[model samples]
Target: MIDLKTQYAGLQLKSPIIVGSSGLTRNPSKSKELEEAGAGAIVLKSLFEEQIEIQANQISDPNDYNPEAEEYLRLYMKQNHLQDYLDLIKRTKEVCTVPVIASINCYKSDAWTEFAAEMEKAGADALELNLFFLSTDLTHNGPLIRDLYIDVIKRVRQTIKIPFTVKMGRNVGNVTALAYQLQANGADGFVLFNRYFQPDINLKTIELIPGSIFSRPEELYDTLRWIAILSGKIPHVSIAGSTGVHNWEGVAKCLIMGASAVEMCSAIYQKGAGVITESLEGLSKWMEEQNFHNIAQFKGMLDASKLPNPTIYERHQFMKYYSNR
Candidate 1:
């Protein structure tokens, strides 16, 4: 008998396969379909702060552009978007048997975070803050920018009673230190390395274009290295793998690196939701072959802290391999 059960951010997941937040999980029907297809949890489509702000900015009076009017418009837009998301949470919760995690994409600790409490009231099992800030300002220093992320988590923690996880970006001065600080500030869990939209240069047009929107399989290693370094280092904080998880093999790799669960979207987009069923079956067969009856038996077996030489994760250059070659 094989048991794939796992725990993430205090929620019991029958499997470690969570349908990540995207257009794939924007509707309740999609949520139900994924659950039926054997998904462990659903991270509902994120409520973007820019979505509200843009709508507010678009409204400018012909002759009189009032700051107060824009402020009121921003508030109204915020509430409208929040209500729609709350409705999604309530409806998805009603249809899906698995945990429903609400997501918010924000760059600052603004009033928008207060809506986290409202989402919990609407039946969201937990919250995942898709936190990212592209620091383009010349004056912005590393520590000052890091503080913004910390402040956002702290504010959200104060508002929501349910467990919340921070889905952070990989570009940081010291990821280990930031993870420790966020954990100290009350992050229940973390989804390693949020995938950002890459930009590509259009040679013919001499313009910038959006690169591939979906994560590729090769992107898994960046997240894997961090998971191996951070897992088991913190107390009571779960680590979730995100980005580049395309199949059961990818899923198993993350588990071995000490991830409690993995968030997948790009795979489902390319292969359909049936990939979930296939991955689960493949994982079970692999586990049986390895003589592992449960997830805990093999999970985190290769994390940096568990290995004899922890420096393996810290090594950046391929000098050793080049020398041997």
Candidate 2:
């Protein structure tokens, strides 16, 4: 039998297909089904920072300039929302054999992070911090924004014993440097890219509208390029390819490029849970064809550092190809 096991942030997963945090993983019943369908691990739907703050504001008087009441309401709202999340973790753990990872969608470091300890206590096998911040401010520079990310990782690291992975957006000036800093600040691993809410124009209406929320298979190339570049560069840190991994071909490519795992959200949304099983079967058949017995045998085989000519990953503009065409 081909060994399909892989590790992500020190968690030994049965397969490389981790269901990314989304509505599919919001309930215990759904988590159990995904596990049965052969998901290596499950990332619970992220508890958004906006959800807590918005609820708190509703309960408290914004006109009243009372710090004490504000603080109390913030704590109350956090706890109320957190209790549901903690319950989800606890109940899911009871029903499923795979690892249950708690997720937090945060923009800044604050008291809400202190609740990471509570998540661990409630039996979360690990934590996935979806750190998001896009600064359009004129005063903000890349370094300052990078520092803020480091601070958030540091705060959570101080509070939790379980291993945590940072899910980062691709908007930063320096991807490798930011990854290095986050790893130094106690990040166990990283998810290469997080999809943000995109806006589109309604040509007929002449107004802004929400863009397609789902990621297409073609979007996998960017994540693939970065994974191949960074996977070989970062030592002892696991990298998970995310956003646009839609099938077994994507999974095999990610593994070849040295990714420990690949997270899928849109794929699962478009296809049903059976997609997980289908991909795993496809991977096993492909491995047999390639004469590989285990994942590590071919993992990172195509990474930039391993190539004779490493500049292929750095080439941009594709002027030569365009000219020939």
Candidate 3:
């Protein structure tokens, strides 16, 4: 039998198929379904810091006539039900047998540390901080943003002893430096590249339209490249590949590139929870065909340091191709 058991952020997972934070995980029934379907772990729907701050503002505002109140309410509606999230973890623990990870998106470092502690008390097997900052201010630089992340990690680490991972974006100047720093600061693992939802232009009305298109198969290429480059570079840091992982082949590719596990949001949104079983089956079939007994043998097989051409991952081929040709 193929051993699907693997380690994610020090948590022993039965499989590497993690149901990423999304609306599906927001529902208790759906979360239970995913657990029953053999998901390694479930990241509860993320509680957005922006949403919390907006709610706090609305609740404290004296004027009821503010037009933005409506927008605030709409944003508030998208927030995860913390009580429900906790109950799901408790109940899933009782019936289902897998790790239930709680996810939180924090804007301020100190403000959300208490909440992280609360999640630990709520019986979350681990916590995944969906740390994000849109550093648009000219006054703030990369070091400042990195410092914010460090502060947040430090605060959360102090409050909660549960093993925690961080889901980060690729906007940083030096990913390797940041990854190593986070590892040193007590982060158990890193989920590479949280795809931000960018607003699009509506030419007809000249309005900014909001929509996050589900990731396509091709989007996995970029994530694969980074995972391959940074896999074994960071000390005691596990890597999870997120975004554009729509199928089992993508999961296999991530493992080969040194990702400890794979997280999926768009695929479940498109294919439903049943996709979990399909993905695992596909992975098991591939392993059998390849004559591999376990995930360890194949994981990180194509990482940059192990590859014949390590520099290929570092240099951009687009400019090189045009200039040389």
Candidate 4:
């Protein structure tokens, strides 16, 4: 049998295809189906900071804020939402054999950090912190923003013992510096590029609307490049690719380029859970053709530094190649 086994953030996953945090993952039934369909792990939908704050705000008004009423109402809503999440984790753990990863989209070090401990208590095998700020403040610099990310990971790390992964955005000016800082402070894994929400203008209605949530196949190259670059640099941190991995070929490319695992959402949304099974099984067959028995045999094989000419990964537009062709 071909060994598809891989490790992500200290947890052993049977495959490399992790279902990234999304609404679909919140359902224990869907989670179990993904597992049965050959998924490596499942990341439950993230509990956003905004999600908690909005619920709290709707129930209690700050202008007429009553300490007793606010406390009661806030706790009531938070508990209800949090209870559903925790229950999902517990129920999913019971139903599925694969690792159940809890997710949180936190922009700061605040009350939500406390929830990490509760997540651990609820039987989450790992925690993925999708940490990023809007950065609307003009005063922010690389170091300050980097420090905030480091602090967020550090605070949460203190709250729970389960291995944690930081899902970062592409805009972080110095990914190397940010990853190093988080690794130093106790991040066990880093998922390159969390897909953020984008806005679009409605030409007909003159209103701002949400952009396409699904990732295009072309977006895979940029993510693959970073994974290849960072894998060679930081071998200690378990690296997973996110946003743009859509098929088995994409999965194979990521693994060969140095990712231990890959997270997929848009593909799942469009293709259904069968994509996980097909991707994993197809990868195994391809590995067989390549005469490799395990993921370790080919993982990182295509790291830029491993290639004879490292410039292939760094070079962008080639007027030379275009002119020649």
TM-score of each: 0.95, 0.95, 0.89, 0.94
Candidate 2 residues lying further than 4 Å off, grouped into runs, are: 60-74, 316-319, 323-325
RMSD of model 4, in Å? 1.9
Whole-model Cα lDDT per candidate?
Answer: 0.88, 0.90, 0.83, 0.88
Q: List the residue pairs that clash in candidate 3.
A: none
Please count the clashing residue pairs in each candidate, in the order shown: 0, 0, 0, 0
Model 1: per-residue Cα lDDT over 60-170, one tens digit each: 662464777667776787788789989999999999999999999987688656789899999999999988787878999989988998898888888888999989888
CA lDDT for candidate 2: 0.90
CA error at residue 251 for candidate 1, angstroms = 0.5
Alpha carbon lDDT at 63, candidate 2? 59
Error of 3 at 244 (Å): 0.4
Question: Runs in model 4 with CA error above 4 Å?
Answer: 60-65, 315-325
Clashing pairs in 4: none
Model 1 residue 197 distance off true place after TM-score fit, in angstroms: 0.7
Name the better of 2 and 4 by lDDT.
2
What is every candidate's alpha-carbon RMSD to the true fold? 1.8, 1.9, 4.4, 1.9
TM-score between candidate 4 and the true structure: 0.94
Local lDDT at 5 for model 2: 98
lDDT of 3 by residue, 1-325 (tens): 9999999899999999999988878776778899878789998888877766665555544465476775666446434445555676677666656888888987777668877877888788999998878789999998998898888887888889999998988886678888888888888998987888878989999999976667787989889988988885764569999988999999999999999999988998898888889999999999999999999999988887787767667676555667777
Candidate 3 lDDT (Cα, whole model)? 0.83
